[model samples]
Target chain A: MAESKWTPKEPMVSAKDVHKSFGDLEVLKGVSMDVMKGDCVCVIGPSGSGKSTYIRCINALNPIDSGSIEVEGQEVNDPHLDKLELRKKVGMVFQQYNLFPHKTALENIMMAPMRVLKEPKDEVETRARELIKKVRLEGKEDSFPGELSGGQQQRVAIARSLAMRPDVMLFDEVTAALDPETVKEVLVTIRDLAEEGMTCILVTHEMGFAREVANHIYFTDRGVIVEHGPPKTFFTKAKDPRTKEFLSQIL
Target chain B: MSARTLIPGITARATTDLPVLKPFKGKPYGHDEIGFSRFLANLSPWAVVCVVMLLALWPMAAMAQAKYTIGDAFDALWKWVPFLVTKGFALNILISVTTMAIGTAAGVLLGLWQISPHPAIQKTAWAVTQAFRNSPWLVLLFIVMLAFPFEITIAGVTIPIPDWMKAVFGLSLPIMANISEVVRGAIQSVPTGQWEASESLAFSRNQTLWRIILPQCFKRMIPPWMNWYAILTMATPLVSLLGVEEIVTLSRQAMEGENNHPELLIPFYGFCLVIFFAYCYPIARWTISLERKFSVKL
Candidate 1:
């Protein structure tokens, strides 16, 4: 394969020694990682392992205590940073989907582009319809989030994020809430996006999907990265005992 | 054949005396034995009103010393009906509508302030809400009526602040506070994920609140808002204490104009009750239906 000879481009998203705490509990302890453009990095870990926290920091959702996170050369941790601009570039899909309950699926996809980006209505509608098709939610455009199934809602959420035309996508356990049967559908949608060369960081528990779709896999334990490598080496020959124990339990 | 003969262990006296198990009669133990009382118990609201009017006026009609009978009092009420409705009840509705408008507008802002990120703004909003919410509506009305000037001159232009207007401002204070709570509750009831989701989408706080948060809250707020309007309309009669000339005050004046007969009290007050009930009952029912309709499944 040409994978071995391929060189990484400049990092599109970089986090250095990120530290964050919630009151007395520290969630991320000096965590750091980098993603080149179009790199699919899957972060896998047990519950409360800071995998979600680290990715959330990239989009400025959870403010870090003592670290620097930059996206596209913009300082995310800076107090004066334009968070709106930062978030526009970094789209995030949460576990619960969180699509607006009042709006239909189409309106949910159209909202951010029209309201935040102030895009033309007709143009946004056209693109939004295309996103709906991309997420395989074509006929469900008029359905509200409450009316759709969990997997379908998650896909619509993905489409909603894509409406803003973000440079990078963050998936924080997007499939964790789905039924076992529906998990595959969502995973397939996400895998297609990753294969299409979207710069993506996924904090997930689906180890098999992570192994199959991600180029690099990061294993975090106790608020820090225990081990990380390309999917083949990382999954088969993990060096750290902690990573081995976690992989053994989940797999 | 006696039960004693049919069964092996039976006593003929006990079996025969066991009040022949007749077909199930009305209520057990003769609780509703009187047909008239049963009819009274089952009366609808309008039926009850009719029965009450008859019972109350029957004695007055039979009073030997009474010069003006119940019929005369009702005739006087009929004479004053047009005036009471147009001038008095209209003002009540007007005050309620105006107060609701002002209260809702101010309350929404106050409610948003309660959830503001700044501690100072949030605390101040909370303090104001608690203060007004805990205060008596009547006391607030009195304070507003007594404290505000009837008219004020601004840059040599005189603007008259009428008494009813003051009443509206007074009534709106408590309504504002309560509506503020409604708004705050509705906004908070929306899952936090919504805020995070909007934030992740790069929506500004104002944009998220106006476009996303408020639209959802609007539906939830309606039932309670209509509830407050009903309560406020009922309380509009309180303004009559300060002589704002609403239905109650007008009814009293109509009685005085009709020689102030003692018999006039029931018919006049009953008219007020019927009109207010007629107006507010539908709103209360509608509020309940709306509450059911807008209830979020989640």
Candidate 2:
């Protein structure tokens, strides 16, 4: 609870005693984690685990029923850091791709930059096109989400998030909806992102991806994190029995 | 479980020709107890009965048709369609378009409101939508006309907004009612994951509603909305009560000879049919195309 004098650069995102409940159901029970400036954290857990809710709290997507979340050194519980600001800093991609179906891939990338960010047209267009190229979706800029395959749409989603030049990116099972063979294309895009040091927190079942891309990996169970450590130690020899059980089940 | 639809390249792969195709190969029509065969067998008598009913209803249909003549209807349509480009048919068009625009905007807002996180907003929206949906549109028109005769004022021109205005207002309220529910239903129909994703992006409630929710709802809306427009067009005659000098009113004048002679009824309405169909056919076809396009997307 003590604030350090130097502030420690206010880890890109920090949550403390974050509790969120919907009706009588408790989704996250006092979750707290610190994500450094450019660290990649992969969250692994079973279906009902709070991985998704935890990240959403950081962006103020799903309000933390009772908790404090901070992004870029500012407290999120206040009315000041509205969704638009948090979203600008913490962009997210969905497991189902969630690309706007009616918009072209280029427009999807350009919209937030133009509308929410209020960036000028030419600059946004250029940056959006560059983002499309980053995700290996250069030629498919004008194509709608429905026109693209599942993997392509997911990549487009990734491009859309990246278009805003966010300080952090959130991925909720980015490739889970993709065909088996198409999964690698999306993972490859994320890998390229991780290599460039874009701060990322991923909720994924892909153990190989976690082991490869994440600097730190956290395994959660029943709304609580059972293990947290560097990927090698956590994936190979987590101290908790739950993590081992999960690894076994997933493997 | 056993009966299959004979649809080939879709439900059936083998049954190419209908004549030799066995009945069991067809798809299930409905009802678990009675498969397509039994259902068809049961429907045979109904079909015969309906044919007889259709024969019986022919006279009524003929009588309805006899109310309007083509010549009188044409005279009515020609007089109105071109006469008052700003005040007559065009005014109806403007009024309908304006009413629909306002109603659609309000309805969409109401629809989104019905799903708001706040209990008060949602409940209030639900009640309003239900009331609008339940209240007769004609009653609404009459009520607006009657209720506003003393209240609404404009630039010191207190010309008690006529029944025509009431008709437009009344009709629009119901349209707004239906549109709001339609908007809400369509928004609800979308996957919950959309809200989750929008939340993750941290779009405000308004942004999420406009960007994520409403655009997705448009596909679901196209069909019902088009149907509403077509039905609204049919109900345009109802506006004549407000004395809007609409097409039907023109038809009545032409039919009655405006010479004070009570003319025959058949030619009177017959003229109406041609005018209505001529205007409505293209819109109906457009709606059909839009429905097909959206259906494919869904």
Candidate 3:
């Protein structure tokens, strides 16, 4: 039994009639979705399904052609301010773990906060150390990205994202590139963030994570969200037949 | 009879005379001629090294009298070391730095200009860089000094401005080509993902550059930059032809003129060679160290 709760009633971020096209490929077609405050949405779909593309557009990584997105009470089309201010509040973690190769793990985490956020050194060091420890990258602060394993690098990337003190963290298949042994550690970190009530929109194939950690689940296909609901109801009994077919392949 | 008719007879004679020829082996596999050719080719590179070394060093060895021991050579060299360290070395270093600075700034601009969306700008920059690259450095120097103003003009101004500026232009002419190619390749080498990532951070096309593109481009670009610097250091001697009172000219004038005369021209040109070595070697070493440093981690 589906709840009769209307979606737009408690939206924190909203995209209305969004559209984007890359060359001749119309990736996002009038797609509109809203996320409530502190919501953990896991977007699951096949490759080229545009779930990753949608999450990227949430941060304006890809500008929409025709629609408007409002984030944290700011309209998408409004200009005149530096957007680093907006970006500081929205952090993104990449699939390939794009840590600065030149910097140590500690410096990688500390750099943005010190340079961008203008945090003092003592506080930066303290926070960076704590975050590194949280990601189980303890005692490896001085190591460069090349020195670390793939799992460790991804964890450092997560810590690097968290250092910005973001209001929302976008994880685009954050563990997809890691070995099976390493993926569990990164998943644990995301799970910890979810349990702590941090807002996260994750695009992942880890159905277990989508089941366990997602407060809300959105199933997208060919750039449109076909259905979305709480994890227990949606993953267990999705309303859309496409969503059912996707789950059948994965589960 | 010829051996053709007497083959069996000769064989029978040899076999009758020698017991070893009685039992022949099954087959022979490898050739000594191939092995000899391989052996010669292996030594060819080392032979080349020795020839070049003797060619370069034999002149000094001949000019070097018994009085000219390594110690005397060192003393003659060392006597001018400070004069070089201050004036001659400084001039050589200054030339390299200035050309490199001009070349890099101009190269980056021209590289972007060459790739500009505007066809006229891109074509112009490409044509100019190609001309700079193809023009021989010494020949270009002579032409720019002697014939350019007479042959070429732009807008309302004549081409040749002044002698000193001519020298600077000549030195930097080829450098523009080198730098244009370097920076163009470097910027292209960076993946589109880097630009996309910066844009994702809400940096505008321009903001993305300062925050991301140039930093990565320049850092990865250090090797070519250092190589240009070294070549520029060695090229300081070319300014002698431009009548720039640079080190090579100063040393040459010191040797030819009567004043401050040594026993022979050896002290003058010999001292100059030492100066070239002293000034250029450390910087070359520093450039190598820089390469090692930059390549170490990232």
Error of 3 at A175 (Å): 0.6
Residue pairs with colliding backbones in model 3 are: none
Off by over 4 Å in 3: A1-10, A77-82, B1-98, B105-165, B187-219, B233-296
lDDT of 1 at A71: 83
Better of 1 and 2 by lDDT: 1
lDDT of 2 by residue, B201-272 (tens): 546677777887778877767766766665676677777776668766665655455443233333345435
The DockQ leader among the candidates is: 1
Report candidate 3's fraction of native contacts. Answer: 0.24
User: Residue A217 in model 3: shift from native, Å?
Assistant: 1.6
Output the TM-score of candidate 2. 0.74
TM-score, first chain, each model = 0.96, 0.94, 0.93
lDDT of each: 0.87, 0.73, 0.72
Worst 10 residues of 1 chain A by lDDT: A1-10
TM-score of each: 0.87, 0.74, 0.68
Instruction: Tell me the tens digit of each residue's lDDT in model 1 across A110-133.
Output: 999998999999999999999999
